[model samples]
Target: MADAVIVVALLLVAASATAAVAQREPARQALVLSVLGVVLAVLFTVLQAPDVGLSQLAVGSALTPLLIMLSVRKVRRQARAKDRAR
Candidate 1:
């Protein structure tokens, strides 16, 4: 049962990652990646690595998502600025 849960979680993460890659919008892609990260973190916890799981949750689920969001925002701002400058 545990192994099955882990496999399902991993599959969800993979699917989310693929969806993120297929998405054209930066915000949407970031959101998908964030979801994938969270799913992976959950999988880690289920696998009995609490420390690794917490670290993954903190870095992947939180920090990475924030960074991605910031980067997307920055890119959008830059694009808008360039458009205005034209």
Candidate 2:
């Protein structure tokens, strides 16, 4: 059971990472990273490392997603401004 969970988690992470790498749009890539981080947090919890899982949840899942969203928003704004200037 544990092994299966681990394998599934690994696959999920790998797939997400691959998708992120393939994505050309910054916002889409960020979204993929955020999803991957949350999936990793869940995998940590499944491995019975509550402390590590919580830390991952807070830092990777929550904070990372927030930062990515902020960056994406800023980038979009800059792109719009540049377009207007042209």
Candidate 3:
């Protein structure tokens, strides 16, 4: 039972990682990366590292995605302003 849970978590993390890499758009990639982070956190917890998992959850699921999305928004905003100026 324990092995099975670990395997599932591993699979989830792998799939999400692949999806994140395969995505072309930054926004989509950010979303997939966030999901990957959550999966990794679960995997860590399954492996008996709750402290690591908690930190991963906070950094991976929240801060990373928020930063990526904010950067994307800023770049797009700048592009739009440039186009308007043109």
Per-candidate RMSD vs. true structure? Answer: 1.7, 1.8, 0.5
Model 2, span 1-86: residue lDDT tens: 88998999889888887987998987777778778778888888888887898898788767887888898899889999999999
For candidate 2, the per-residue lDDT at 60 reads 79
Judging by TM-score against the true structure, name the best candidate. Answer: 3
TM-score of each: 0.81, 0.80, 0.98
Q: Rate residue 22 of model 2 by lDDT.
A: 93
Better of 1 and 3 by TM-score: 3
Q: Which stretches of candidate 3 lie over 4 Å from their true place?
A: none
Give residue 10's error in model 2 in angstroms. Answer: 1.5
Looking at model 2, the pairs that clash are none
Global lDDT for candidate 2? Answer: 0.84
lDDT of 3 by residue, 1-86 (tens): 99999999999988999999999999999999999999999999999999999999999999999999999999999999999999
**Candidate scoring better on TM-score of 2 and 3:** 3
Task: Kindly list the per-residue Cα lDDT of model 1 for residues 1-86, writing each as its tens digit.
Answer: 87789889888878877887998987787778778778878878888888888898888878887898999899889999999999
Q: Which candidate has the top score in lDDT?
A: 3
